[model samples]
Target: MGGQQSRQKHVALDDPESKYVIPQNTHKIKGLSRYMSAKADHDRIVATRGWDKHDENMQSMQMLKGLFKNLDPTVMKAVGDIRGDIQLSFKYDFKRQLLLIKVIRCRELPSKDWRSKMSDPYVMVRLLPDTNRQGEKKTRVVQQCNNPTYNEIFAFQLDELELMDMKLLVQVLDKDIISRDDVIGEVIIDMNTFKFKENPVHTAWYMLNKETDLSITGEIDITVAFQMPQSLFVTIHRATGLAARDEGNASDPFVKLTIPGTSVLYQTQVLKKTLNPEWEETFEFPIALEELEDRFIIFHVVDEDVSSSNDSLGQAIVDLKDFDPDRGMHGSYKLADLRNTERIRSKWFQRITAEEFSEALYAHSMSKQPSFIFQNQRTGKRVNCIVSS
Candidate 1:
């Protein structure tokens, strides 16, 4: 346990339930979880939301337990005091087929290190593989040397990192050789890698495939959800790199999935780009519960119009049980990936997705209502509004 030693640990992903979802599914009432007893929030949600049946949903419940349990007791020293929560934000980089991590701090810090004399330390981050995408070859790691403050972050360039599983390991090494007794603050790995957040209006698509036939020979209409604070001129800026905005060459949008639940793979659409800022939006596409009359998915292929910064926009997955009412969506969620697309082994996901999905949604129900939890941007006051789903 050396203070400055580099220890590579397999980040055991605790599939804690999160309430955040896509498009309109994202809306919820804030502070709904607080009415329960300690560790009772998850159970409450399960009992009330039909999530108890799904083990994935249970994980969301377990995650809620872990979050409060993992919190620095000092932060919640007083009885009845609430704990710190995790937030998810996303930015689709069509050019790179990457989702940019955007987290705002309470106060801003300088971009470069030389400007201040604060005890800025080294924050190291690495991607941990999610079991679903475990079939792929190797994993990638990103080491950030001179990050500025607690607000400072370490990001993995998906293209360069090539981490198929997208699991992450984050840490802050007290590079301060002098302060061996470093009362160093924290190492935040926004588990929101799969769940990202953005203020500007954005779009995401969760699509479904036809369950009757397996051959993807016919044309597939991509199901898209456009979530925006306000509407404006929005179009695929080439379905490629956000860095290099081009419109002509891009992939056609297509949906893919796993029956009972589904996960969609957008063409170049995953790396969607837009020129406007100050817009907040989201989009979702649906997929078929069964393709070719079977319950499995390899990967969906959509033609594109241009090459991305890496020529591919990774992949997007969803819950099919949501589409088919009887599938019974459970679990918070447990995601896996592949270096390349293939027919998903039917056995792979049945184990954890239901529990993971259910628990995650229940846990998420508490935090999703930021309109009530966080203070107003201009006037520092907790907002209270009739935020309905």
Candidate 2:
């Protein structure tokens, strides 16, 4: 029995499939005891080798930590701070009503391409809740760099009222030529958290999170008179320094006025071959005085085309917050290019009542003295007389 058991243990050691064979001897048999002693020795050898390997791995990790400490402290600190995020700086100009953003840099970006181990990155910024793509601004792409330095600045025009609901969305994207761009991370900044008056320029590093579902997307000129109780009279007199849309000739321009949230749309006749086109057109809309505060007047200067679609020259937006019904408001407003958000041309305008117009005409016509010839017949005994006509 002892001989058979010894043979079985030797066979189990030789054959890989029989590694789970159990020992059969209960009492001290020389052959079976020798086999058991051999198995314990083999187990002890494996355990000692495993412990030695673990100590060697720990020593290598400690050496790596020492080498990293010898390198740049700033780089190490930044790497530790921004594990997977970006940094942004902000500035607000109350006088100009502009919100400026500076995308400083990005850190610790994940490798989008497994083979190349890097990503072509760019920054996209937009005002939140924008549906028309108007408030979107993008930075130029940086090639093949995980840690990109973009000292790029972007600006957005926002009024005091608009700032209340304004939120800025900053997105870090991986640029792909053939396929759609990949969004790596995003950060949304609430404008209300900033106290612009106290600190005009606020700079801070923000953690990049998941993308937002929100998205977004202009103008005109005229003399606007608000007649007490219910009447808005707009006169589009003329536009000067207008950008020519046609190649050969000057722009064939016209004016379009739109009162937002209402069915009111007014357009003037198109003038041919002129940069400075005069419409002299007056329009009236019945609007309650209370509703004036809630409405914005948009004047679009469009160039008429004979062969193709009409092109927009420029626009101007008018707010009636400071408008006085009795006094009225009138000036030459500089038209804004909504695409670039820059001032382009100026348009002359005036706002006045019907009675005021009649009075001014009467005063102008009566200003000059009337000619009389009672003296010419006697100019032989000439006497000249002035008469009011």
Candidate 3:
């Protein structure tokens, strides 16, 4: 298709970089001729700050201006927002198939550096059980963050994990610690679909009132484990009633558990309060299972005023099959042999009074040096305790 006949003496403009003689309606580069286009584009954001991105971020630190005592711990410590976004991801390899699980995001909402939006979530590790091998069982592992920072990211691999335990024990670290009540928010991802799960099972959170003088010291080993099918046990409160208040509006403060649109397992909203901080409780609920198709262990906080979300206090995704179930025993585990072993376990703790220990032992605080041993009637394990006045 060469110039067949110079049909109409055609002329074409070949100026690729030319900014001159631009059409009126088209983009005119009149001002562009004076400055470098690349520089001008990038400089738009810099012109206002007059500093590099890193420096701008540093300068943005506004000396943490708010009620210092009221804000969350992170802001109280003199740091601005989180250094970066928070992430939690892990994977399981079973029979050549890969199972990936991760938290999509845990961003702080726009309230006081997002402290109100902060969440203390439960983390677990599970190694898929081998069905072919009947004798072998699944293993579940549960873990709690010792010092959970905002948007804290975590990644780990459970080596040959389940044959014993594969679930994570996530114990929230804060001023108030409740088995199911500490939940303030959640960051969840679906196991099957690999999508973000909004309302998860056994969501947990905790809070410390500004007026309370409850003093906690050292690293109070927060533990997470499923003591039974419907109930999960959490141990926190090194010292609960520092203000010496009785069980009232400020005293009998308990973790109110309520699953959204579902019936509550705990018949009462008041579990235990500030009267005794050393006391611990287990919240039993018919939730979190593996073999079931209609999964629902998901829940939120109990609001006395409303029927809807009490701001959805945190979230958790739990698989009963992937957790180390605490059936209570001193002997080796084998569900069939549980009843037989219970006898031996009972004999061991027979000398120890369960009711007395449950009540009297609560007088001891973790902060003080131990003066007595509190044994579990079922497991026969002794808990070190100390009296604090």
Question: How well is each residue in 1-389 modelled by candidate 2, as lDDT tens digits?
Answer: 11111100010112212321223222323332344345445545765776554333333333323222222233232222123567788888889988889998998887788889999999999997564356689999999989999999998887767876888888899999999998887777788998888888888887665454331001123577876668787777788887767887478888777665444456788889888887767777668988877776777788899899988776777778777777777767777544212121111111112223333333323321111212234335433432222
Going through the candidates in the order shown, the clash numbers are 103, 15, 34
Indicate whether candidate 1 or candidate 2 has the larger lDDT: 2
lDDT of each: 0.31, 0.62, 0.29
Indicate which candidate wins on lDDT: 2
Look at candidate 1 and tell me the lDDT of residue 102.
34
TM-score of 1: 0.20
* Two-way TM-score contest, 1 vs 3, winner: 1
Reference-based TM-score of each model: 0.20, 0.39, 0.18
Worst 10 residues of 2 by lDDT: 4-13
- lDDT by residue (101-182, candidate 1, tens digit) is 4332211111122444333434343444443333322112112223232333323446523433454433333344354522
